[model samples]
Target: MSAVLSPGMGAIEQAALRSDRFRLEREGDWKRLDAIVTRIEKGRAKGLPDEDLLALPGLYRAVASSLSIARETSLDAATLAYLEALVQRAWFQVYGPRSSLGEWLAGFIGGGWSAAVRAIWIDLLVALAVMVAGTVVGWLLVAHDVEWYQALVPGGLGETRVPGASAAVLRETLFGHTEEQGMSVFAAYLFSHNAQIAILAFALGFAFGLPSLMLLVQNTATLGALLWLFADKGLLIDLCGWLSVHGTTELFAILLAGAAGLHIGRGIAFPGDRPVLESAALAGRHAATVMAGVVLMLVIAGLLEGFARQLIDQTAGRFIVGGFMLAFWLAYFFAYRGRRQTAGGHFA
Candidate 1:
């Protein structure tokens, strides 16, 4: 064995001293993390105490930092290998494959989706801004020149916006007599249409988000044109009451779908510290959860549009129903997220 080196020695001696001190200070933490990871690898994370689980993420991060320093300093071969292997194991524990379907599903409904939504509040705000701009532009243009109504809205969907449909015709169209199947068919059709729009908005986000933005603009433009028509007939308030019965939830669902798309687009544009592919993959996970919840919103909206519009017929009742549902969503995504544990029960 070499003689003990004095303080302030040569460069090699200094590096050796630092490596030794580093191990001495952190070996205990590494061992504890290794043990926890071993238990998790054996599928025993459920058996870990809450305190132990809570400590895992911090320990894992510390180890990662150590690994980075070790690599940068060109530590001894054995030290470097050990640190690398340890970090890999801990990483698998902290961010690896999920445990089971039932576990994930339970987590999702409990708070996972809401938490995901809250995380993207900024994106959602942007989507709402874009949508509102489109709506405002559409309302102003069609209100200024009625001919622009057909130019903005699609021909098939603009049956309610013919050149000279009187107030009574448009009013009947709102609370109108139906074809063979009544509200059931109408509800189903609305759900299908909205689902298609929402899914398309989400799917098109990968095209750098432009397509999703355009789609939103088109949808809101049609909405604005219709609003102008209803207003012209001296039924603006009544038309709002009719739409409020379901439009709040329906439009909000589409907005979330658009946000999901924008997230993917942003991941592509700005990956930050992560690789572009990895960033996009992470965004996909969160966006998928939001889209899943959006489907539920669409269903609720469809039911309200079909039944509430037909049965209630009163503006206050419509607003009350829509407002209550909107309040519930607001609370679900914003109010309850902070207090819940994410997946792995604090293991993350």
Candidate 2:
């Protein structure tokens, strides 16, 4: 052998001998060691920021057991050092602060919703126009149908149709219907229902929230048609008074739901810079937050729809209740924005 080879032979031989001995020592506990390695590898692959810290207990226990086994077999120091390195590498991976799959998914959902909102503002304007047109068409159609029926059916059936009921009477009926339930019951029902609507709004993004939008448009149109009919009959003031009790709040909740649907739809339609799938995922997160706000609105709306509207028959009382609800919504959303700005400015 060369002079260089001869000089390193003693150290190299010692390491080789230790490695062989360690292998023999590990054989009895090979399965446990394999399991530990597998877990460490899996944690590393997950790329979650705190995975290493979370895996430390398991890794340490495995190392301690292996060390005990090595000691029992009188394994060399070099072999112990090699094993320590392996464990350390695993430790580094598990405790690192890399983002996980879940965080990525959350980002996608959030981004998608924001994009959708921007896309749908135009559609909302179109929908509002459709609502106005539909209202006029529906009222006219209902009126014509009523007239035709009266001409054909004659007497007693006409009484049931009642073409000229007072707006005050309708307002009283609206209030009476609302009073059938208590505040707590109304609140709970609204909360649950609103949650359902919001979730549905988000989930319906599967169909691109199209069905949800259609539902909103149709609803708005129906309301407008009814209002127009009442107005034409010279009961507009009375009808407005009756509707002020609950319609204002309830209608606003529906509008929010429509906005949420629009948000989801736009996300699917226009993912922007990212891949469509990723963008949609990001939008979903933001949509969910907005939907949460929507639920709060709906809960308040339900209170107006049920207890308050029913309990207060007077038009002035209805307006007062409705005005308060509107103010609360504005304060929570618009007012909260200012607070955020102030905090951000201070931090800056």
Off by over 4 Å in 1: 1-38, 41-103, 156-160, 176-189, 338-348
Candidate 2 lDDT, tens digit per residue, 213-253?
66554454445555655676666765676666665666555
Error of 2 at 72 (Å): 24
Against the true structure, what is each candidate's TM-score?
0.70, 0.53
Against the true structure, whose TM-score is highest? 1
The clash tally of candidate 1 reads 0
Q: Per model, state how many residue pairs clash.
A: 0, 19
Model 1: per-residue lDDT, tens digit, 1-348?
534557769988878877887788789888989899899889787788989889999999998998898899877788889989989988877888555767666677778888889878878998999899989888999989999988877655536556478998877766643342436554566667767879999999998878888888888887888788888888788778778878889998999999999888888888899999999999888898899999888888887777776776577887788788788888888887533335554412
RMSD of each: 8.6, 11.6
lDDT of each: 0.81, 0.55
